[model samples]
Target: MLRYIAFTVFLLVTGAAGADRLETSAGSVAVTQVVGGLDTPWAIGLLPGGAFLVSERDGNLLYVADGTVNRVKGAPKVSAAGQGGLLDVTVARDFTRSREIFLTFSKKQKGGAGTAVAVVRLSENGKRLTNLRVIFEVTPGGSGGRHFGSRVVEALDGTLFVTIGDRGDRPAAQDLQNHMGTVIRINRDGTIPGDNPFVRDQAARPEIWSYGHRNPQGAGLDSQGRLWVSEHGARGGDEVNLVHAGANYGWPVISYGTHYSGQKIGEGTSKPGMEQPEHYWDPSIAPSGLLVYSGKLWPQWKGDLFVGSLKFNYIARLAGTPLREVEQIKGPETERVRDIVEAADGSIWFISVGQGAVYRMTPDT
Candidate 1:
């Protein structure tokens, strides 16, 4: 069932005016609702003319403009079961001319359900979608409902990166023969990129870019165009990794965290060939969304990373040479932050699943 909280009570908890002014490490900022009355909003995308697209976990797409929210048609059918549904939406780089957008969802397949990516043209009026086409779908769809790591990101090089979880099949993460627990790199048309790390490996899936992830729900590109992912750990080892081509991120093998039952995880925390996380959380915050700030509005935040915590009801700000959590941005408005993105004007936008709303954060004068 979807979690619901009284918005009025939330506002009262913060302050008057339905906006919260919170002091952060950088400075005081105002958190205001952009839109509300949503149902389990999973991801958000910025559209031209200042409109927005918000995807709900139950297969509803919302178009919010001028304070009015409308349902958008033409989203693909989703499984909507156990952490699965319409997940992420991304606007095309040339959206002004292309009117195109990309979406990632848990598709119902022959075996059960798996993550899939589809592209569609938003109608000029923004009331519906057009020319919808499935670009890619996970092969060997699994039966379970948990751990569909389905965050889609457009790389600086124009290729697409889709994050997939272990699908609750731990051992599958270490096998390159399947798509589980891996990052996939593909062209816009859903074709495998020739330069993908495993494209030439006969025993590996050509689309595999990196492997051994747990449940990477958050992905973003930093200023230098490098991909970074924030993933859930078994019990307490949530991690933020600087993803590299063909790198093995020790999942069921090594971890700073152990099983929920306090049992030791595989072979300790370091293995010979497995990569270490840039940062990790021992107590586990259940991280969901990621953003690498450009600092257009706050210069001090440039090169810093922002992550949403589903379990903690806060946004984590991390920085420094070795990388660490420098601050926590939290309030009643930050409940279950599912996705975080930077607006074109450099303001921050995020989804609050607990409150069922979209919020924007801007520096206070």
Candidate 2:
């Protein structure tokens, strides 16, 4: 049954794109393609000036404004191999004054590559990045082209939260001496936060906020200012977790999933000390970007969470305290939805990686 579902999703994601309408529980949605000709676009950051900063997995930074997309220069050299490459991009809250932006990418090093975060100043005309400097990087880089989890989210208090993967090394998730498989919290200037969980632990990385995560690709704050993350599981067990400081989310130590070879994993699912997921999926949907809905545009959807499903090729709308998947949104043009965001006007925007386009989802009249 899971294989059948996956096959169906594969067809949908690979189908030709032309349809402009999608039927949803709330109402009909008009799907408009904003721009195309992108190469494996990874994430989108909305600018205060009503533009967009888009990053491609091939290490290109693009500025999209008024239907025109231009490649921005001065991006750091990245290992554009497999899952490694330029990933998420975010603009500062005070962009008007600071013109600062944050970017996450897979940084190449001697042995292999690791997730890295940097801050740069966007030029006035959006042509290039200035003052570019890496703010945070995962240490003890290992080999392999998979699991360079890089997602950046800024807290309301102005701290930056970066999600990193285990770098295909399951045991490393339990290690505190390195930055692998951890959520790192740092100040805007790349300094460790004094209040960070491991700040006083001389043996641990001070930037570590939480530990034992595997490929956390999506991160955002809820309406109440709480951090939430969506992470990928091994064969199954895709999870939505409410992140907290000093907490440990069991990865290889305890997983609701099995090895790719279909063997049991880690002393069964539940453990005494490991934190449990708010929600999990048995047949993983390969969740990527996540956003808690405000219902500003869709009144009924307020407070719900929207997730981009790479495995299923749809948008999963989840609600309730312990989150549950309530709906899967599908349209003819819908491709592998990579990232999701709510526009200032309340409309939702998402990137379709399979189609190489950005799409707007608005209410159909």
Candidate 3:
């Protein structure tokens, strides 16, 4: 069964009687509400013609267009337990011709639940989804619900990268036989990419591209087509990593943060084979959605990275050679930012779980 809601869209204006303005390092930005009355919205996909899609954590896909919000039918059945549920959504690169979209969610498997991906064609009317297909499913499902890590990114080579977490089983991150705590690459049709890191490794899963990740909730492609992810660490070690093929991110074995109980985790921070994060946050901000800005609208922010802070209620802007957080874009509207992205017109769009609304930010004129 699908649920419907009345959505309100505020007028886009700068300094227009009661407009929300956020001051930034570059300049002030006008924040306009795109839509409101959402429940735990997880991700947003901006389609052509100014319409957009929003996926709610409780298994509802919403299509907002022509000043109306309608429920998108045919979403896959989700576990919707603990930290797992319908998570990320990405529009197909050739969406105009294909009308296809991809989704990541926690699938209800035999033992418990695990992350999975599906591809479906949106109907021309945009009211329902058709041709639904389950493209990928994590093997060896876990018993608990924590750490689904369900972020999906489409690479420059027309392949897909799906991030998985340890499922609260820390040691499984080091094991290569299972899909837990790993990023897997696949073709749009769900076939394993031949160039994958472990394609020929008899003992490793053929779909594995990288391993040893804890709970990577956010993934994005930079301007240069490089992949990056925002990961959650226990206690204080939230990390932004430049993802590379076949590399180990050192989750349980090496972490800058300690256990939640205040005990030291792993053998210190640095290990020979493990890769260090490009940036990390102590006292954990609980990072989620990540975006590599194109600098189309804001030239000064070219090549900068934007990540939403789930715990701190802000958008982190990171730049420079070593990649450090340069600014925190925060206001009352940014509370519990779940996902952030660049719109077609170069405007910045983000979802705020705290506000239960979608907002667009533009340079205040």
Over the stretch 128-215, how does candidate 3's per-residue lDDT look in tens digits? 9999999999999998889999899999999999999999999999899999999889999999988898899999999898888999
lDDT of 1 at 28: 96
1-365 per-residue lDDT for model 1 (tens digits): 12223433443443335667989987899888887767889999998789999999999887877655667888899999999999999998888999999999999999889999998999887889999999888888989789999999999888999999999998889999999999999999989999999999999999999999999999999988899999999889999999999999998899999988999988999999999999999899999999999999999999999999999999999999799999999999899999999999999999999988889999987
- Of 1 and 3, the candidate ranking higher by TM-score: 3
Backbone clash tally (model 1): 0
Q: Give the CA lDDT, 0 to 100, for residue 112 in model 1.
A: 89
TM-score for each prediction? 0.95, 0.94, 0.96
Sort by TM-score, top down from the best? 3, 1, 2
Model 1, residue pairs in steric clash: none
For candidate 2, write residues 40-140 as lDDT tens digits: 98998888758888898988898877545567899988989989999999888888899999999998888999899999999888879999999888888
Off by over 4 Å in 2: 1-19
lDDT of 3 at 141: 92
lDDT value, residue 219 of candidate 2 = 84
Residue-level lDDT for 150 in candidate 2: 85
Best by TM-score: 3
